[model samples]
Target: MFNIPASNIAHIIQLAVAPVFLLAGIGGILNVVATRLARVVDRVRSLERDLPEADPDQLEVGMRELAILDRRMGVCHWSIALSTVAALLICLVVMILFITDLVALNFAIPVSLLFIAAMVSLTLGLSLFLFEVTIATRFVRVDEQYIMRRRLL
Candidate 1:
């Protein structure tokens, strides 16, 4: 049997559960951000591929769209990086929980700090994702598309 008492181990597991859940949530966020990044990249590549055949006026529009896509891609990348860091910090917190229990040491302060840092990182990542979404909506030619559809109809 492990040197730590079963009750102590159980307590540590209980304490670790919340952080583990947080890690899973972070993972989900990362997945969404990664997918967004992939889509942005694909769009950029498609625009670039078509640029050469574009008329002068169309080329200008394509370039502007490419710039916006570039910004979105950068935002997605940062969101993913920060979320990943948060996930790693959470993993460390869980590891420390087990270590502290086994050694019977006071690690409450460090654990709390790590958890806070992870939250901060996740918040920033989520904020960036929001910003990217905003940019996507802001630059979209919704009115133009609507008019075009109406005319076709």
Candidate 2:
């Protein structure tokens, strides 16, 4: 039911092109985040499966690692969710642009707000991703934890 004016169609498409690029970038981020999320999940699951049979001497260390992985999973999950929301908002912005032209409706404010919100979501998501990566790297070695514990004491 798009009765978009022929004269306005080109302009609308041109305006929407920018958001289309945003959507593409968000999709790329989501893909990379999802892949990393999958790997984290697999490792967490493997650790859990092996925990019961873990050497008694190493059980505590294994459990501690598992806890860190769980936190990472939560962070990763929200990062993915936020990225998805940002992508959806970008999609809505593109749709609003076309709808604005088709119905001669004022959508500038809505479009701007949606675009801004999408950007904020992406920013927050990426920040959390960075935090998760930092945490992931921090505990990579057994000796690192002892050093961190000493610093905290």
TM-score per prediction, in order, is 0.91, 0.87
Worst 10 residues of 1 by lDDT: 1-10
| Pairs that collide, model 1 | none
Top TM-score prediction, candidate number: 1
- Please report how far candidate 2 places residue 123 from its true position, in Å: 0.6
Candidate 2 C-alpha lDDT tens digits along 68-95: 9889889999999999999999999999
TM-score of 1: 0.91
Worst 10 residues of 2 by lDDT: 1-10
